[model samples]
Target chain A: MALPDQITFASSPALSRNVVDALRAMIASGAVGEGEHLKESELADALGVSRGPIREAFQQLENEGFIELRRHRGAFVTTLRRRDIEEVYSLRIALEQLAMERAATRITPAILARMNEVLDAMQHVSPDAPASEAVALDLDFHDLVYEAADHDRLMRSWRYIRSQVSFFLQVRNRSHPDFVSVGYAEHRQIRDVLVAGDPGRRPTRSSTTSGDALPAPRRSRERPGLIAASGRRDPA
Target chain B: MALPDQITFASSPALSRNVVDALRAMIASGAVGEGEHLKESELADALGVSRGPIREAFQQLENEGFIELRRHRGAFVTTLRRRDIEEVYSLRIALEQLAMERAATRITPAILARMNEVLDAMQHVSPDAPASEAVALDLDFHDLVYEAADHDRLMRSWRYIRSQVSFFLQVRNRSHPDFVSVGYAEHRQIRDVLVAGDPGRRPTRSSTTSGDALPAPRRSRERPGLIAASGRRDPA
Candidate 1:
């Protein structure tokens, strides 16, 4: 099978980052199976780099929860066995909601235009096209919202959170190409909210609870906020 | 000034983790100034350990965004400046709200009681108590919910998000002892919500926006949720 596209290894300066991305892309594309033990020497030989960069890449991946390093034992790709996809979806909602809120407060016409630009780009990436295109647009659309929020720590935190889903999303999209269109509609919904402008200054009915931004998840099929249907937990 | 207590150095076994906590405590206590370069060798000597552990500890801190590793230069503690506390508060709202929601669904009586146990322990930790006591309880209260949520990645991501506020929280408590009370009350509010149980299953007004669970930031002062006022942005 062909390697997953659009995950071109980044060049120079940060050599370990390239290895990290390449390895992550491999994991995403199912080039490497889950629960596989990743030997440093094997990866070093495969990537044709020294073990130092391989070790560093392993360190970076371990930090991101992509891999685990046991004492004396080498690194192994992390298994998300007990952690259900539902929890991941919920986190995406929480984080993206915060990002949307901040983006609403800080977003300008130019930024809104940029999101629409991505949306326009999304239309051209047909469902029959490579899932990477879908993944890239999906990542870009959500990323712009966080980027517009202008919070360094939030953005940094999102990057780590996104890593967990990057491969999973590609797999999901590849299998269900419908996610491309479905996800675009979700992105448009977010765009509509931001286009409505800063809700931070708008007065709303007072409530004493947190999560005031989201109504309770009354019905499961298609919750209204933050790409809900994209990842609803099928009744377990 | 005496190093603000509660940050004792840990002995071997997990030396790097111990170093991470000790260094974090130092940062929290202002022993290490923000933007100061941290020499691994100096830190090794000072902590009575070798450079290997110090390097590993520094890597950990850098991953948490506490320190920056320059290309040629060594590590520097990141200045939380330019980082608006308002953004930080909102992030806490997003993360903790989701954690609270999940914890509510699966929280055993055992965990709830454990939180109450911490709360009970907290009272003896008077406002007059070392700010560290308040800090520890504050950390414990929020941490239990994430832990109870039982999602490893969520918990891991929260830990990283938390490092940004930890030093700020300790310093905030040191200076504003009143926040200790303010924060406790807020934690109690969340406890009440969880005790009420199943807000996720409960019906509420439906909304399309991402933050439908959260009401608009009507006032900058305390609003309901997890500890609100403790981290409220000072009107600069």
Candidate 2:
């Protein structure tokens, strides 16, 4: 049977959303360098869209902490300094701890079942897959934990920080071995703690250092190499 | 001794910082409403600046999550929903817990002395003083606690959430008398707990349904009224 035209159509047109998605991908892909200017005409031309929608997309992106807009100068990608990175990860730890504790009480059987599926997938994926795949799976596992916490605001904040850190994670994953194994073990421990249904489980002060304690990369001038490795043309 | 001209004169003009500050005030002051268009030309005219500086300011603001830019459409003030409020507060709870727990070990004598002063001030504030003054002092007290936690990242995240909630607190404070008193007492208790120097002291699980439970205000059509109450605003 042929479907009605209304049934076949999506509720909203994709132009605005597509622009947002494209811009986000560009930023996330590291095509846009930190503090690089965003020329409206060039971006609009590249995206094959009028300046109006592109401007709107920029506003949305700004709210999401992806880009910075200047009054008259123009927009630019943000630079996350060591201090900024530290602040973000610290917040993440605090929020993750809260989510773990809340999941102890709020995690349902269904949520746990879905989490188990993700864990199984992680275990089964060939280690030969590009490291990015493992990174994505790691993000998915954390996202599931946030979902189980059932706090909408925490989830949004988490998304903001996650986006900011995604590039850093890419660099870190490339440099670190056993990153996946260590992260997976932590996830399993978190899940076990949640399943124990003890909301009182406070995060022990094991190490104040960041995951694996790799020193933060020094600011680099090898823009071309970084851009190529990160798979994005420099927005600058 | 008289200061030298070099010392007295501004060595470096802080145009970018000033612009960021001005734009933040406009947003925080309700001079700009959520979802209202932040036309670059209009803002430039209002701030007595060229489009160049305004563009820079927008970039900074975007990084701070204060405004959203749409392609061609222009930037708009962010409109946070009820769910955003809830998520922010939940994150706040987690961050506060982390800060409080760590503060137990890291609270310096200076910090402790400052806290004692603030608590003493809170106890003796004339009921006749403007509510704004009281609120400002209260915020300062909390800020001190955050500092004592010695985690810059956690404090930064907390600052962002607190700014978002400031608008709501203004309204909440007007109707709730015990809000100030109860909060004062809680602050005292938290201080005492930290003073015990036990980093392992878990936050008591107070009943969630008590009178102290945060009041969930109904969404209203009125513009946020307390935007201008504080001159210091940090977007993130």
Largest DockQ belongs to which candidate?
1
DockQ of 1: 0.44
Deviation from truth (RMSD, Å), model 1: 8.4
| Tens digits of per-residue lDDT for model 1, A75-191 | 876655323345555676667666766778788778788889998988777768887777778788778888887777678777876776565566455446576676656667667
- Model 1: runs farther than 4 Å from truth? A1-11, A198-236, B1-10, B48-51, B180-185, B199-236
After superposition, the stretches of candidate 2 with alpha carbons farther than 4 Å from their true spots are: A1-16, A205-236, B1-89, B99-124, B128-133, B143-156, B163-236
* Per-candidate DockQ vs. reference: 0.44, 0.33
- Best TM-score among the predictions, by candidate number: 1
| TM-scores vs. true structure, each candidate | 0.77, 0.61
lDDT of 2 by residue, B75-163 (tens): 77777655445565566667777787778888999999999898888888776666655666667777887999887556656676665
